[model samples]
Target: MPGPLRWLLFAVVLTALPVTAGVLVLGEGEPDTAPPETAAPAYSSTPLGDLDTATVALARAPFCDRIPEEAVAEALDGKVGPTASYDAGQAAELAPGIKDVAHEHGCRIAGPGGTEVRAWVFVPPVTRDRATDLVTEAAGREGCSRATAPAYGDPSVALLCPSGKRTWVSFRGLFGDAWLACSLSAPSRLAEQELLDRTGRWCVAVAQAASVVE
Candidate 1:
């Protein structure tokens, strides 16, 4: 070959070598080893025996009438004041929902020393998925955290939130296609576990009462 042509070929080969080497290096790069995302915690699937087959409906009279005063007193560890009831319209406004899709019958019982309990049952027109979503969202509130407790319904979530001088305990669960929620507020000095236990008892009582509504 002539000198000029041979030199041109040599230069082209050198340039192609680097390009090929770069391709090979990139092809042999390490695989992605990043950890997988964590999954949500698992919960029990046991249904509440009493509510599993009951025909759940809003109580004809005030829901407070179904809940015995003794139950309330035991749950709060003190005597309770008069119970205030919220009808469907008022309950719809007070409870959170989308376009008032949920019709809830709620009641508030005042307890001694700045403590209180509020319970509500979501009647027909409310879907179970929507109720579960609401419960999950409530558990994710800023100061709220999930707590371990006995399963009340098919599945249940309990949460605790401490605000200012008061601590709030909440429990929500699904019974058949219906759902119910309850919240208790007490002085922050109360033990969190104790509050959770009380809240659970109150929740069970409320659920039992609501399940038998006609």
Candidate 2:
């Protein structure tokens, strides 16, 4: 399937899935449970102050490299896989206007047991206001809603968008002139609250790692 079509289909599957008390649909067969070994890492809800002045040089490297492998492993409770680079071409195909305002670069990090996290950095020339507008539009999309906890960065926002049996949880914030976001699809069978808690920690880890990137 084409990239856009595949994503659209995924979104449709997410919206169609039922979210019942204590259980969120994942797929056929019994709902899977999260083992204690894979529990969410401890985190602080405090926002990272340095993001207000941090900067990223995308021309020098992809954003994913800046995130520590150990942090990623602990956040998702899984082994980290090779990082895949997302280029401007893919961004244009998904959202054309993205290229006009800033240079877009992203990384998709795969975790053990099929879980995945994706992070992006929109290089300078993209203002905080524009970033806020983009994040608001995304949060308002069907099956997507705002997440109020575990916030970080200046003018930050978080969202949870259910897709099929899993939920896509993300955190985004504007740091200086750049926009950064981290998103992940939670493992199936975990309770709704557990899922949210895990995603929140994942966002915090990504933000903490991003904050130190010069």
Give the per-residue lDDT digits (tens) of candidate 2, residues 105-206.
Answer: 666677776677777666544677887787778778777888765444556777777777777777776766667677777665777666666666666556
**Candidate 1 residue lDDT tens string, 1-214:** 9999999999999999999999999988968789989986642222233344234443433466677666788667798876767766652434322234236777778888878888877665446777677777877788889887766554568888888898988887676666677878888898887787777777767876776433
lDDT of each: 0.70, 0.62
Clashes by residue pair, model 1: none
Worst-scoring 10-residue span by lDDT in model 1: 43-52
Off by over 4 Å in 2: 1-61, 87-102, 212-214
| Top TM-score hit | 1
- Name the 10 consecutive residues with the lowest summed lDDT in model 2: 93-102
Q: Give the RMSD in angstroms, all C-alphas superposed, for model 1.
A: 19.6
